[model samples]
Target: MSNPLFKKINIFLKVNEQTIDSYFNANDPAPIYKRQLSQEFEEYIMNYAPSIKRYSTVTYKLNCVNESDKEYLDPLVHAIRRHFSLKKSIREAEFKKFKKRNWVLLTFSLIVVMFFQGVMPLIFNVEHRIHSAFSNALDVFSWVILWKPIEKLIFYWNPFLKEISIFDKLINAPIIIVGEKKEVAPMEQEYAA
Candidate 1:
């Protein structure tokens, strides 16, 4: 079913072609492609929310209301607000936790890198031990050791930022608080008596 109220709204974003294609291909870009891909879902909501309220007894209105000026009537609106608030909290928490985890991994990788850079020369004759197995291993290991830092630096933060942004939009979105109207039935003569 289609909702006409939001038919003209355009929330679609322009991004890389590969990113656009990935969304349709059922590819799992997850954290990496989150920011661009999430726009589609947001667009979907922009179109659907009006229809949802139009059909249900629940309705929503957008306006500036001070804390003291508001009246609460519907439980459904409260539930919806609570759900989005919880989502916002989870998004914030995930961002903090993921950033901390990335920092920890980066620090460990830095230690491994520093051991090779500063201490290795003093403790082991790396240049003189050329062609030895341990020397070769060190040569290979140094490059391999950089992977975590590279990954954490380049790709790790995208998911948290994108997800948090999505949650923020959702939590702040104005929504229907309650019933659209109350129908009053006319009294019959017998009932009027």
Candidate 2:
């Protein structure tokens, strides 16, 4: 029998690889790539716990909220959906391309974001706040540097919690309390016959 833990890790990696490829394919080299990368990072977190999947789905649902305002929301939804769909098209050709120079691609992305968010602002005399550029660089760097460690922690923490039930109790106690509580209403319910 296959270990469930290993099965989950495999799924997590597969989904992330798909999400990355989708974002990479977009021809326009805008600041949005950084956002997409950050999003994929969150998706990696959700792969382990099924309950947390709602958070990711809610993000997609937000795209559908203003359907009548197609002029604004349509492009945003198309871009998001296109990036996600590319994950499904992964194959030997794409894997080979990705394997050869994943680091190079990451570095190029950082350079593009820095140039636009950093140098371009100066060149164009745009007086945007410094926080915009700094935040973008920081986010990209954090995601790249932190991805592996975060994955390992999420993968192992579940089993570790199972082994040490004490930690589990501590973490789960609040959830249990909230689940058991009843709130009293100011007004009593009245039924008319």
Candidate 3:
């Protein structure tokens, strides 16, 4: 029977054994076994050039081939299986990391919101005095503006809170712009050249 690897190479499958080896050595040694399997498959493809027929999705079979080649192809088949398994593990780990980061950010943003909500009434009464509908509205607006900096500070200090909601971001925009303005000092009359 022909080696499947050899046929894959002929069709430009683009599997780099050396690169695979390097990656396996540097991070994960498991794929090395699969790389060896791939090489063996390539050898079989070169020798027999087996007539391959796709049986199903991700499954293939050799037609009109000798049974003798099966012994040599076993390792190659095992290697392919191992490679896929390792690839799946890597992907799962990455997804978990992404989820962890997202969760942390979300928790932090919620905490900031809670903190703001708790302090709002006290701070508003102190700053504005005599709470009324207008004062309450103004205080809420001021709190919205300050939320960004407060959220950022909390994130920086805690490192655990990172998730910020769209509402929180929108509330911060106007305040951020307002915060950027510098007070104009009393100007002495100076003629521009």
Taking all chains together, the TM-score of candidate 2 against the true structure is 0.21
Per-model TM-score, in order, reads 0.50, 0.21, 0.39
The digit string of per-residue lDDT tens for model 1 on 1-193 reads: 8566533322232223333343232454433322233345335444543333322222234222333223322222343355556777887887788778778877887788778766666666645655366655766787788787678768878766655555455445556322233445565655766
The C-alpha local distance difference test score for the whole of candidate 3 amounts to: 0.40
- For TM-score, candidate 1 versus 3, the one ahead is 1
Q: Model 1, residue 176: displacement in angstroms?
A: 5.5
Off by over 4 Å in 1: 1-73, 126-136, 176-193
Best by TM-score: 1
Rank order (by lDDT, best first):
1, 3, 2
lDDT (C-alpha) at residue 127 in model 2 = 59
lDDT by residue for model 3 (51-169), tens: 32221112223221234433333343345445444544554565567566656756676666566556655666654545566456655765675566556544543212111221122
Q: Give Cα distance to truth, residue 60, candidate 3, Å.
A: 3.0
Reference-based lDDT, each prediction:
0.50, 0.39, 0.40
Tell me how far candidate 2 lies from the true structure as C-alpha RMSD in angstroms.
22.7
Q: Single out the weakest 10-residue window by summed lDDT for candidate 1.
A: 67-76
